[model samples]
Target: MATQNARKQDPQEALIDDLRDVLADTEAMIDDVTAQGGEKALALRGKIADNLRAVRSRLYDAEQKVAGKAKEAARATDTYVHDHPWQSVGVAAGVGFLLGLLVSRR
Candidate 1:
């Protein structure tokens, strides 16, 4: 049951978990470097800071791209539904019925 639940975990949740782990490790490394207190530690901290900035920038770009795509998809779907309301309704009802049957079986 635990394995099944793990397998069913959301992709976004998994990504968040991975990000949290990375953040925790980074914090630990920074703490260790601070305790050491040397020029090399300073350099390493600078490098880590740069890498984090780069990662943050990439994540922002990815978020923008995903949001743009989602908006485009929503616009297209809205237009389609408006153009063919009956067809959209039929499709939705069919999908709902199928889902109900699948849930009942499960």
Candidate 2:
């Protein structure tokens, strides 16, 4: 179970993680370059900072929306399972059996 959990990577989560890494690196680069004295550089830096802020805001909003939807889906599934316990069990069993068959064939 632990190995299986580790093996499957959610692509969206991976993309988010990569984006965070890039944002961090870009901010660090901006900070490192801030020491140079130039009007154009300063203006460019300010513009970049503003754009990063907007990107961060949008990313945050997207994360919140995804989280809310996930929570709603979880709640609905829970309600369905509670309402139809036998049906849920039967569906899960069917899925598991199908997976077992495919895995064995491979």
Candidate 3:
């Protein structure tokens, strides 16, 4: 019961938090560096902006792809369940029984 209530850090969530920290640190560094000079600073700023835009676009595309794959998997699962309801129920019950046995042993 205590273990079930404990919060778990998912690997994907941890990676996202780490990425956010890195982007925040990079933005801070860029702000500090761009404050001193003139034309060169302006050019650097433009380059950074363009690179950031590209990164954002790529991230968007990857996110969309992941979402698409998940949707496809869901559709497949829905189809299977619809086509074999009894088999699905049996499989689920078997799995639950196995899990119960394992947990009771623990």
Candidate 4:
């Protein structure tokens, strides 16, 4: 039960953890660079920037994939209804009539 609770955390919690780790490391690097002077701090900053960019790219790709899948599903549904207009209309009407009958009885 404990494991399940941990596993079922809101998905954003994992991203938040990752961002927190990155921030902590960045803070540490900044402190180190401040104490030590130039080259090492610049290198750490560059690495942090690269990591952030990669995370952004991955997020963008995921969004695009989800949108594409949604559009494809909508198109497929539209095509199916177009191909079976009478059947779809009959089914919808039957459902509506049944609901109306039940409501009137109550």
Greater lDDT among 2 and 3 belongs to 2
- Residue-wise C-alpha lDDT for candidate 1, range 1-106, written one tens digit per residue: 6346446765544454455556668878988997899999999988887877776666666556666877999999999999999999999999999999999998
TM-score of each: 0.74, 0.76, 0.72, 0.49
* Regions of model 3 farther than 4 Å from truth: 1-22
Q: Which lDDT value does model 4 have at 84? A: 100
Per-residue lDDT of model 4, residues 1-106, tens digit only: 6346547754544454455566667667666766776887678767766776786676666556666877999999899899999998999999999999999999
Worst 10 residues of 1 by lDDT: 11-20
For candidate 2, the clash count comes to 0
Whole-model lDDT per candidate:
0.77, 0.79, 0.72, 0.72
**Model 4 weakest lDDT span, ten residues long:** 10-19
Instruction: Name the best candidate (by TM-score).
Output: 2
Clashing pairs in 2: none
Query: How many backbone clashes can be found in candidate 4?
Result: 0
Candidate rank order under TM-score: 2, 1, 3, 4
Pairs that collide in candidate 1 are none
lDDT of 2 by residue, 1-106 (tens): 6335435745555555556766898798688768775887788799889988987887787677768878999999999999999999999999999999999998
Top candidate (lDDT):
2
RMSD of each: 3.8, 5.0, 5.6, 7.7
